[model samples]
Target: MRKNIQILQDIVSRKGSSKVLTFSIPHVFKALQLLDKEGFVSRATFAKEIHLGEGAVKTLILHLKKAGIAESTKSGTFLTEKGKKLTNQIKNTITKECKVKKSSIIQGKYNHAILLKKYSKMIKTGIEQRDYAILYGSSGCTTMIYKNEKLVFPGNERECFPRDAKTKKYIIENLCPHEEDVIIISSSDDPFVAEISAKNAALWTIAIG
Candidate 1:
C-alpha cells in the first residue's frame, strides 16, 4: 500500500468538492477531515474531486454523520472540531513513523546500445507522433557515445567502472550536458544518480517502479 502521507498529499492537491475525501474512502477520512477543518474544501467539492456519483457521496456523508466527525448545514458539510483534531493527530503520527534515510550507491557498467536500438523504434514512433528526444544516462558513468554503430568517446574501452563520490561528481560534471534527460540503472543505489536528478530538474528518473 502507498504510505498515508503520499495519499494525504494527493487528497490535498486534488481540486473539486470536499467529496474528494470519498476518494480516500474507507481509508482516508482522517486526512480528509484536516482538509475540511482548514476550510480548504467542502463535502460536495470532495465528491467531485473523487469522481463519485452523488448517491455514493451521500452514503459516505451519512457514515461521517454517524461518526459525528461531520455535520451538514445550509452552506455544505463541515468537519466538526473533533474531526479536525483527529486529522492533525493522524498527520503527526504518520510523519513520525515514516522517515527513510538515503541508501548507499552501487556501481556496475552497462551497455545500453542494444537496448537503445530496440527501444529506438518505439521512441521513433513517439517522436514521429510528437516531437521528443531520447535521453539516456547511467549511474555507472560508462556510457560510450555512439554514432553510426561506432563508439565515439572512450574509443575501444567501453567497459564501465565503479565510481566513488569524487569520481561520480567528475563524470557528471564532464558528461551530462545541460537540459538533457537521463536514464539511470545501477548495481546499487547511487547517490550520484540522485545528485544529477536534483541538478537537472527537467530530467526524468525511471527506477524499477
Candidate 2:
C-alpha cells in the first residue's frame, strides 16, 4: 500500500517537461473516490465535484488515463480494474466518519471528522495533517489518536481537549475508533470543503504510513 501511495504521490509531480499538475496527491485520491462512488464521471461533473476548473479536470483525466487507472467514453470516465482495487483499498482504510457540530474546539461553521485506521504511529505532533488541510484550503485540522480509552494528541499521552468532555464524547461515540486509530477533524465555512479537508488529511496520513 505504501508503494502504491508513493506511486500516487509521484503522479502529482511533473514528469520532465510535461505540464505542471494542478491537482494535489489528495485530489488524486478524491478523484478516484468520486469515480468509485458514481461509477462514471464527466469532465464537467468532475470539475464541479473536485472543485477544479475544466482545464485542470481535463489534464487530471488525461493523467488518470495515462496511469491506467481510468478510461473515458460516451458514458463518462470509469475506473479500470486497477483503479477499483486502489479505490477499495482507500475506502477500507478510512473505515468511518461523522459530521461535527460547531463548538469552542472547532474553528468554523462546518466540520467533519474522519477515522484513519491504525495509523496513529504515523502522527508526529499532528502538524503535518494540519498543514495538509490548510494547503487544501480548509480553515484547519485537528488530529487526535484513540489510546488507553482516551483521545490524545500525538507524541505523548496527554488527552486532547480533556476539558471539553461533551465534544470528546460526541467524537468518541460517532467515530468509535479503536486503539491506534487516528481521528482528523477539519473545519471550514463550506461543508464540502470541511469534508474534503478531513479526507485530504487522512490521505496524507495514509501516504505517510
Candidate 3:
C-alpha cells in the first residue's frame, strides 16, 4: 500500500523541469475510476466527467501514458493492465463514496462523503482534512471515525449528529462503514465542487497517512 501511495506521489509531484500541473492527485484517481467503469473514454468525455479543461485533460493523459498506466488508440483512451491494478488498489483504500443531503453536521447545499478504509489511527485532529477541503473550494469538512457502530469526530467519544437522527440514520445505513473507517464529508454550493472537495480531502489523508 505504501508503494502504491508512492506511485501516486510521483504522479502528482513535480520533477526538476516538468510543466506545472493544473490537476492534482484526486483528479488522477477520479480519471482512473472513470476509465475503470467505462473501459474506454475520450478526451472530451474525460474532460466533462473529471471537471477539467481539454488542455489539462490532455496533459493528465500524457502523465498516465508516461507512467505506462494508460494508452490512446483509435477507440479512445483506455487503461493498461498496470492502470487497472492501481485503480483497484486505490478502490480498496477508498471503499465507498456518495452524495448526501445537507444535514446538521454539514450545512451546505451540496455535500459528498468519502470512506477511507481503516484510517482512524492516522486522523489526529481532522483539521488537516478540513483545510484541504476548504482549499479545494468548500466552506468546511466534517471528519468522523466509525467506532462501536457509530460515527464520531476525532478525539470525541460521543456520536456525531446526535441531534439530527434522520441524517445520522441515513449516513449509517447508506455508508455502512466498519470500525476504524474514516468518513470525510465536504460541502459546497456547487455539486461538483462538493464532490471534488470530499475526494480531495480523502486523497490528502491517504497521501499523508
Candidate 4:
C-alpha cells in the first residue's frame, strides 16, 4: 500500500518497462472520480482528500494526463469520460483483490491493540485525527464476511484457523463499529503482506472518505 505520491512516481518511471501500470494510478483516479461524483473538486480540496502535498498531487495529475484518462483545468482536474470508463474497468478488474464498504457515520473508536507497531503509523495518524478508519488484517486466503453476526469464509476447517475466527470476532465485538465507518479488509497467503494490504486499505478508506 504505497502512498499516492509513490504510486504516481512508479507509474511515471515504470512506463515502457511494463505494459500495465500500478493499481495505485487507477486507485487515485477512482478516488477522484468518486469525489467528482457530485462535481469537480478544487486542486487543493482534491489534494487534501487524497493526502498528498501539492507537488506530489500535481505529479499524479500529470500521470493521469499520460494515460489520457484525466483532464485538468483552471477549475481542477477531472476524469474525462474516458477516465470514468477506465475507472470502472479497473474497479471490476484490478480492484477486485480487495473489497471496501462504507456505512453511514457511526460511533465508537478503533481498538489500538490490534495494530502492530511496524504498520501503526498510518492508522495512528488517522485515529489521532479522529478520521474514520477500519483496520482489517488476516492471514490465509479465506474471505470473512460478517452478516447478521455470522462469520463466513470460503474453505474447509483446516484451511482456516480458529485464531483467524477469533480475530474477526474480536474486531467486530470490540469495535462495535457502525455501518457508516469504513471497513477495509485485505487478504493474502502471506500474513505480513496481508497486514500491509489492510493498512493500505485503511489509507484508501480515508482517501475515498
- Highest TM-score among the candidates is held by which one? 3
Local distance difference test values of all predictions, in order: 0.35, 0.85, 0.87, 0.42
| Better TM-score candidate (3, 4) | 3
**Order of models, best lDDT first:** 3, 2, 4, 1
**What does candidate 4's lDDT look like per residue over 39-77, in tens digits?**
566668756555556766666677777766677778777
TM-score of each: 0.33, 0.87, 0.94, 0.43
| Residues 11-91 of candidate 3: C-alpha lDDT, one tens digit per residue | 766667467888887788788889999999999999998888888888888878888889999888999999999989989
lDDT (Cα, 0-100) at 121 in candidate 4: 22
How many pairs of residues collide in model 3?
0
Error of 2 at 87 (Å): 1.2
Runs off by more than 4 Å, candidate 3: 14-18
Write the residue-wise lDDT of candidate 1 on 21-59 in tens digits: 433322244325345545555556756554466776676
Model 3 lowest lDDT segment of ten: 9-18
For model 4, where is the 10-residue window of minimal lDDT? 102-111
**Alpha carbon RMSD to native, model 1:** 16.8
Best by lDDT: 3
What residue runs in model 1 are displaced by over 4 Å at the alpha carbon? 1-27, 30-34, 37-40, 96-209
